[model samples]
Target: MFKKGLLTGVLLFGLFFGAGNLIFPPNIGVLSGDYFIYAISGFIVSAVGLATFTLIVSLFTGKGYQELMSDLIHPKFALVYLVALYLTIGPLFAIPRTATTSFSIGIEPVLANEYKGIGLSVFAIIYFAFTYWLAVSPTKLLDRIGKVLTPLFAGMIVLIIILGLQQLPHSPMNVASIDYSGAGKAFGSGVLEGYNTLDALAAVAFSVVAMDTLKTFEFKTQKDYKRTILFAGVSVASLFSVLYVGLALLGNYFKLPDTFKGNVGTYILSEMTQRVFGPSAQVFLAVMVIVTCLTTTVGLVVSISKFFNTIYTKFTYITYVRLFCLLGFMISNFGLDTIISLAVPVLLVLYPITIVIALLVCLHQLVTLSKVGIRLTMGIVTILSFLQVLSTINGFHYFKTVISLIPYHDIGVPWLLPAVVGVALAIILPYQKITKFKNNAEEKK
Candidate 1:
């Protein structure tokens, strides 16, 4: 039981604490300054809310997130969700960011000034090479690296927190214009920033891995499985809350240079290392960043490969892994900034839809609706979400001038109102008898 719990903690932390996680809170802290508490609260709502929803989905369905969603909705909806999830988590966005960010923070500083780009290219080549290698091999190496790196990351983070606190008195007061504004804006921005971490999405992906881990322990009874999952969930939530809070506070206290714009994780680590450790701090930080990033890249590769293999049994794992890694590497060459800019609009659309589905799954018993009702609600949500995403990308003004005025401009259109309306419609809509029978049976007990 103890080992099982520890494994759960390890897996959850490994999934949650990726390179983006390291960067976001500190950036929020620096921007938020005195408003740090409110900002962190909002960030926690998205991060922890997603995590909690993921745990609930894993426990009740006893299937992978994709499988559960597909069962609840149509198979076509499941395919769209899976493709969006992959693009969100893999080659198009998150995976490439992993390689690029790691190189920027981990390798660039140590090289001769002229050689930095060349150095980055070389390191990225090697990093993804190893990513591809382990991805194809499918061994214990990925897990071993995760076990080693997660503890080191936790320790390094703790050290950073302590150093920042020690230097707080000497740091200047909050001077940014954004910080002068009310806490609500700061908090809302922070929440949006935290969404960039995509840990919540990763949590859903990793739950299948966690379930497999439980099965290996011979958790024969339903009670044992539930206890194990709950234990794991608590462990992950506790660790994430502590670390996220600590990092945000660290960022809040430090008065950094104006040059430290964008790439928050890299900026914080570089600045803090310089202050705390002097010139040599750069080299130390670079090494730590590389290792942490590499561990994440490898784990993602392995997990994604495993997922694809399950879905596409005919294709060899090696073939799929290599193809995906190569695609990820090609995409990484485009650099981090571009990927992030493109991802935001898409994530804005997809996150609400995913959350709605997960929430419905969790409240399935209370829903007491036919499958047709559920499908109709889901369809409505998806359509509205796509419209919002399009409007965001095409510019809000264009949308306003061309399309009918959406009611909720303050919180953005196609969000809470559409979702609520969909739910109400589902409740009120009539459905065929066959669809109602199974849904009623499942909800009753």
Candidate 2:
């Protein structure tokens, strides 16, 4: 159990630690500056804390997200939610962004200016080819990503971190990228920044892999299952904390120029590494980014494809994988900026609901809430999410103003109060189990 648990934890870490994970912390460090301690504390709450909560909640249900969420929410809603979730994490945004980021930070800097476009094109093809090769076999995934790739990436990352620490300046510049005038505001900003990691959502989605790995290890007893999963979550969380803090400190130590500001996590790390380790840092970071991105991209492809094939049966898992990889490869050429721009609206809509649902899942036994209540709560979240997204557009300044009036809306989550109200209303309303129509597939199982 110990050995298997460690491997599963490492695998989970690999899946969760992608380009976004690598980029966010250091930027937070740069932004928070003197308030680093307060900021990182809040960052960990939403990043590591919520993600750990997600894993624990999924373990309780002992089922994939589809089954668990479907049982709680309507099956139709679950299907739509899942489809959007997978696409956001897969070809549509995360996967492609990984390639683009790797190219921009790791490869583009070293390439001649004339060859930037060609360099990105060639790199994307090679990157996705490797991803496709590794992801083609689902069972072999653990062998490749967990056993081999993750360890390699970890070792390299450790070396970079060690080198960065060795060369750390005696003092940080203590510059504030943003006005973190108070601990409360700094913490709130940190929490919002940490949302870019998307670790919580990945934890929920990857619950399928975690459960499957446990089954493969032949842990049948419920007690053993819980123990092993707890170990894995702790292991992943510990490692994430170490990496996040280390990277953030590295960013502070450097005090990079204003030219590198605005989504400069990759630049800070890359430049710091090069400064510490010389030209070799470029090669090392490039390799690390590619391997890290590939592991995550492959994991996304496998999980999404497997889920789709299981539910729809319109295509085989491999077929879905190929299609996703193809799509990811095409979109990757759009570059990191474009992908990030696209992701904002989708994430704004999805992240709050995900957080609320995961929280409800965790508190399921303690709360006397019906499915209707939960649905209503999520409905409020969805409406607010839509409003939030709309507020991002040029013509919706009024909506943004109104949303800003909500408590914590300034912190980026305007839907919290409405969701709470929905929950309160549910608890007060008459208790009733609204009978849901189960599909033929669900009936067979």
Best by lDDT: 2
lDDT against the true structure, per candidate, is: 0.69, 0.81
**Residue 81 lDDT, candidate 2, scale 0-100:** 91
lDDT of 2 by residue, 1-445 (tens): 7777788899988888888878888777777777888888888988899888888788767767776677667678888998898888888998898888888878998888899988999999998898888888878877888999999988887778888878878456558655454677788888777777777777767888887777788776878877888889889999889988888887767767756544678888788778777858888888888888788888888888888899889898889989999999899998887888788788778888888888766656465557678888999899999998898799999988878888887667789888888777656666754333233476567
Relative to the unseen true structure, what is the C-alpha lDDT of residue 84 in candidate 2, on a scale of 0 to 100? Answer: 90
Supply candidate 2's per-residue lDDT for 97: 86
Index of the highest-TM-score prediction: 2
Q: Write the per-residue lDDT of candidate 1 for residues 126-244, one digit (tens) a residue.
A: 87888886556544642665467677777776786777678776342555346325576666666667677787777666676666666667776777767777777777777778888
List candidate 1 segments past 4 Å from native: 136-146, 170-172, 175-180, 259-262, 365-368, 394-414, 424-430, 433-445
- The lowest-lDDT stretch of 10 consecutive residues in candidate 2 is 432-441
| Model 2 ranges with Cα > 4 A deviation | 261-263, 366-368, 425-428, 434-445
